[model samples]
Target chain A: MKQRNEQLPPGIRGFLIRMGQIDRRWIYLAVAVAIAAPMLARLRFPEVPGRMAQATFDAIESIPPGSRVLIAYDFDPASAAELEPMANAVLHHCASKGHRIALMALWPLGKQLADDAIRDILLEYHPEKVEGVDYVQLGFKTGNEGVIKLMSTSIAEAYAADASGKPITQIPLLEGVRTIGDFQLIASISAGTPGAQQWVQYGDSAMPDAFKFVAGTTGVQSSQLLPYYPKQMEGMLIAIKGAAEYEMLVTEKYPVTRSADRLALGRERMGPQFVAHLLLIGLIVLGNVSMLAARGWKGAAR
Target chain B: MSADRAQQSSGAPKSDTRLWIALLIFGAVGIFAGKLWRPGPLAEAYVEVVTETRVLAEVVPAPTTQGTSTDVQSAETVAPTSLEQENAPTTRVWVELDDPRFKSGELRRVEGVATEVWDERAKVDPKKAREQIAALESDAEKLSAPTDPTGLTREEFEAREAARMNALKVVESTRIVASPRDSIGIWIAALLTLGIFSFLVRDNPFYKVVESILIGVSAAYWMLVAFWSTLVPDLFAKLAPDLVRATMLPGLAPSEHPGKDFLLALIPLALGMMLLWRLAPRGAWIAVWPLAVVIGTFAGMRLTASIEADFMAQIAATMKPLVAYTSSSAEGAAAGSAFDLGGTLAGILGVVGVITVLVYFFFSLEHKGVVGKTARVGVWFLMITFGAAFGFTVMGRITLLVGRFDFLFNDWLGLSP
Candidate 1:
């Protein structure tokens, strides 16, 4: 290693070492440029839906039209950047398929996110849908999995009234609903605990065959949820990439006439994602090269 | 010492000059960039349409001597004697047109007054309610009869009954309207985001101030949310439904077993009060009891839930056939080539990883010879898993950063195309 380094030009070796020792602020600046530049350019790439994305799409599609679907917004604004796109996409997909939707939340702020989806996606695209007849908002419950357990037995007991304070019994959509089992499909867009995991445990385990279960989780939470995929979870969407792929499949099947940009949030975000990943790969390569060069330098000195 | 002091003095101004130059250059670049990347028009301002309305005054009269009497039928039949006069002043209220009651005709518009009112005349009278309940019961009985004429199923009859019961419950009508968006909020958010990013340059007062505000605001927000969403609804409503409905939640549904619910709610209320007693000057030790109870109950609940959900479920999922075969099509059944090589390899890999990881954690025996090799393999698997987790964490973090930038550009500056 020493002989090899001695044969190489000192200027090149010194340059590599200097690059390694460069200020971290410069690296931050580089990353910023890499992300911001691509975003400003409106760069976009076509997404080919993968197996997981396909599974998620199929899960919702397999259910008959007008079948009741419960979407648990288990994420808050903190993870909205990652999960909101998928939430919007899923809501649109379900509504487009004419599924009678029920929205609930585990996290306190999750209700707000659900409300945003209702306002932005559901109401915007499907204005003809009546509130009580076509859909309902169950809102947030205090008990985490306990709520799920209660719902598994009886939804009315779990939620006496909807988010608007309308009695669950009075809601035309919930008339025939006895329990969580009444829903044809259940999807949980989750960030952490008391989320998809809790749903799988308390909700799915109670009546495994009653309804199909699917989940959309943040990248970090995906590892924890991976074990439940293909079985407990009939479908799974992991992070922004998953969101983008799912969004593509959804929009392809059910294209919106107005405000198409709303559904394109995930794909638009993928531009910065591509550049950031490339920058990361570049930094990793640079760091490794620097390490090798320094090692050779040390050997030559010895 | 004099020479060293001179060198330090000379270096100080040089560093200061360099800092000033850097600041100047960055500021110039930022200004020029902002100009070059012109933003789109500001978001349109939305207005909430609030309409004035009148709601029925929810004034329950005091019980009369006749009402207190043990004659259940009499109590059910007689109207309250102290009912308020019809000439009582109506209060003015503003409700959003979006309220469901407006659509349901529960809140009807006063034609001349140009405001909606909850008709006091439409209030459910005690006698009428009894009659309605009796009628529903008779209808339900007919549906349940051996030779049921009504085609309605048992569930459908029950659902109608439930709806009737819900309608009979007395609830106060109230107004609700959303707060309009303000520019002040947007500016504050943008400044705070920038302040946070300023930390990358160096620690400064702006970053510290932003950090403190974020912490304080988040804590206060969480506390308020918990109080209103959890404690009030779950605890107070159960304990004192009428009071909660009257004051905080006008829409709180009537409970069937109020007595049982109150008794059950009292246990938690007592525990909560004890927990809060730690803030007092005396009997701080009382808090420990509730804490212990909470921890014990939580542990017990989590233990059972984890065992059933995580342990058993995961084991069931992982115990798969080592050799996975492709589902043969009707025509392909005779071909004798339905082997799914990829799935089989994945299954085998999963089994190997699980076994090796278990071997690594087995500290009962000394890790030597075959055990050492297996443990090493386990370490490799563990490393791979960790690397994947780390990559995911990084990806999630970057996405968050991207989100913040998206807000700054699209929302704040409207820079993105």
Candidate 2:
């Protein structure tokens, strides 16, 4: 490669070499433009529900209406940008189906995120639903997976009271909910450890057939979780693409009359994502081309 | 060395010039483009709802000739004493009332339920007042012990009691009128974001300041959250339920086995205090005991969990038949025509991939024969997996960047798209 570069004219060879070593700031600017331009133009492409997305939808839809469902929020504000869309859609889906919802958190900040979802999605769309009767916030407990383990045996022991300090015994929704086994379905919107994986190990493993489980995870965390899908986890949604696809399926079935944009966050975010992926692909290709060019045609072929 | 220094000094000016020119171009282009695509006047995404405040108490119906009237009593009928209001348990509820501010026949649900309404305060539930007041008096007596186990001084204890009393009173009645967007908070967030982004150009004091603030705030925030969420609920509440319920956690439910729970909780509390002793001038070694316990307990828990969840489950999942078949439909299964080609190929590929990857890790054989070829195949499979992972990571990172940009444009600049 050095010999070939030396053989070429200094200007052309230097340019070719420089292509790989261009200041990273320039690339950052290009990315910014790629993302911002599409966002400004509102370039959204229609999302078609994929296999995993359809499976996720079916997981929620198959559950009997008014069946007890627990949604464990396991991500904080840091991962909310990626996970919130799916969280909103899933909450809406469950509420629209009239499933008795119970919200809890493994991550400390997860409770705040759950509160945001309840205020923005659940209460906004389903105003007629009462808090203690139709839904309840068990809030954040200190123990990570230990909470799941305890809940697996006895939920009343795990959380003595709801977020508001209301005793679990007094909560009408939790009348018969002695254990995690009482819930018909469980969904974990998780980012890392003490999350969906913990739920699967401690909660699901305790009573495998007691409840159906589904998970929504960030793209980076998806690889570690893929093996559990379709078996241990009945459905899985990976990253914003999965969220967008799932949102399409959910909104089609249960459309909101007001603030429809709240549910369209995932689809709206895909515009920038689409352009940014293209830009990344272009950069990857350019990088490879530069390498090949520096090697010369004969060397590249070899 | 002198010549190299001279060359570097000479090149610095050119580099600086290039950077400035690039910045100018970007700035000019961005401004012009934004102007061209400007939607309209800036609009805040959140709207303030105007609401009025009212305190309603749940009163027991009076007995009548035909039985108690099931109707809820008017607020005027219930006039509880200040002491009763201060000590009684309360539940906050929102009631939608007629307001001229709302559209005709449209009721605005104020205060408690909706996010738009603000300053919805707790009102005492008179029904539970007698029991709660008795519990409070009992708890106060328990707290008035000779030695303060919680390590609070007399002044602090008195202050806490005063705060507790204040917390129980009906909060000030204030109407939430419409106001402008929270410009101050938005500006602070926007400036900090920009400061962080400035590092891409070059490290500067602005970036350093923002970095320090973020680190300090996050550390303090997490500490407070942990103390309240973990220590208070799990340790302190268990040990002194009455005191905790009265002072710190007003909602702490009555423990069934208070004596047993207190004894068990003491173990952790003692260990925690011992761990904190590291900050003392002497006896720092006490911290090591808890440290060992933590590590040992963690290791023991992880061993069984990992073996079950990751090791055995993965192995079981991977051990699949190469020649796979799936039932296409009920009719097709009845006719014995459910040989799925895709499923078969996928099964074969999965098995081959796993085997080759394992072979690559096996170092018993020399790399001069078919073993080397199989190892190379494994390398290909490994590379493909890594490529996919890298792609996903890149996608995730880009999404975060998109989120930041969204905040800047939509929230900060009030740009809609």
- Displacement of the residue B196 alpha carbon in candidate 2, Å: 1.2
Q: Give the worst 10-residue stretch by lDDT in candidate 1 chain A.
A: A1-10
Candidate 2: docking tier: medium
Chain A TM-score compared with the true chain A, each model in order: 0.95, 0.92
lDDT agreement with native, every candidate: 0.78, 0.78
Q: Which prediction has the highest lDDT against the true structure?
A: 1
lDDT (10s digit) by residue, model 1, range A2-87: 23333433698888877777667778878888777777777888888989999999999999999999999998899999999999
Candidate 2: stretches off by over 4 Å: A1-17, A63-68, A98-100, A159-161, A165-184, A205-211, A297-302, B1-13, B16-174, B177-182, B226-305, B328-341, B362-373
CAPRI grade of model 1 = medium
- Listed for each candidate, the true contacts retained, as a fraction, are 0.72, 0.72
lDDT of 2 by residue, B1-417 (tens): 577556645644555657755885877588557755865333232222334554332322234424312122111222245778765433222333433323432223334443334443232222223344566556555545444428888888778877655544322212222124454566788889888988776655678799999999999999998898788998889977767866897656677898999899999888888899999999899999999999999999999989997788878989887775676666665465667889899898898888888889897887658989988888899999999999888767877988898877776665664
For each candidate in turn, give its C-alpha RMSD to the true structure in angstroms: 14.4, 15.0
Candidate chain B TM-scores, in order: 0.64, 0.64
